[model samples]
Target: MNIDKNSVVTLHYEMYDANNQLIDKTEEPIAYLHGGYDGIFPLVEEALQGKAKGDVVEVTLTPDDAFGEQDPEMIRIEPLDVFPVEVEVGMMFEADDPETGDVIIYRITDVADGKAVVDGNHPLAGMRLRFKATVDDVRAATQEELAHGHVHGEHGHHH
Candidate 1:
């Protein structure tokens, strides 16, 4: 069957950055809710439409098509004293917003004697993403799977 809305697709993918550095890869097949669900990116779903099993595709997406452009408001500098003594650059920590209690991930970008710069933007924000995918299987989703809005396997659980 062809990959289309509500179809279950299993594929292996290798993702790269504009610099050609490997970002992520699937050791096994990854499954997702296709056609605008929260599983894969919309652009990728659009690209996979009508494709069949064994098809290999290489697609490049701009920031707008992938993760959105970086937002300057996501960058903030806080006094170094606010963090624990052992805090180091590249460490990710969650901070709660005072008004909403929403947790946000802040990655330490810079550290100095008394201040630190933390950025909350997605690591890939503002960068192009190149995806190399090999479709392993494409089939009609079972009624239960469709109702659950995800895929179920031999283990009898939805992924």
Candidate 2:
């Protein structure tokens, strides 16, 4: 079946950085309720429209279209005592955004001199990405799936 609005699409995808280094790949295919439900990247959804099983698509995304540009302001240096003693580089934790009061995930990038550098930007932020996907199956989405704005069953959301 063609992938269109309300279609349930199953596909395998590989994500690579600008350097062509594989960042992520689906070991098992994934399914999503197609057409603007935000189930996948908008650009990718657009590329998949009208495609059928066995079709392949490759798209290059700029930083803005992918994880977004890195915000220098998002990086802050805080007193080490503010974080757990176990905090170390590469550790991620959630904290409230002082400006918006929304929860923001921050990753520790450095620790020294009683201070820790925490960055709120997504790890992939500021980088271009290449996405490659192969359509494995396509079918009309069930009413329940459409109502939920997502796909259900194997390779999809469980609940």
Residue-by-residue lDDT tens digits, candidate 1, 1-159: 899888888888999999999999988788775666667777677789999999887889899988889989889989987777667799999988777888989899998877888998888899999988888888887888878877789322445
Instruction: Report the number of the highest-lDDT candidate.
Output: 2
lDDT (Cα, 0-100) at 104 in candidate 2: 96
Q: Report the error of model 2 at residue 125, Å.
A: 0.8
Candidate 1 local lDDT, residue 120:
84
Total clashing pairs for each candidate: 0, 0
Question: 70 in model 2: Cα distance from truth in Å?
Answer: 0.3
Residue 89 in model 2: lDDT: 96
TM-score of model number 1: 0.85
Put down candidate 2 lDDT per residue, 1-159, tens digits, no spaces. Answer: 899999999999999999999999999999999989999989999999999999999999999888899999999999987765668899999988888999999999998898899999999999999999999999999999988999889999888
TM-score for all models, in order of appearance: 0.85, 0.93
Clashing pairs in 2: none
The reply for model 2, stretches above 4 Å from the true place, is none
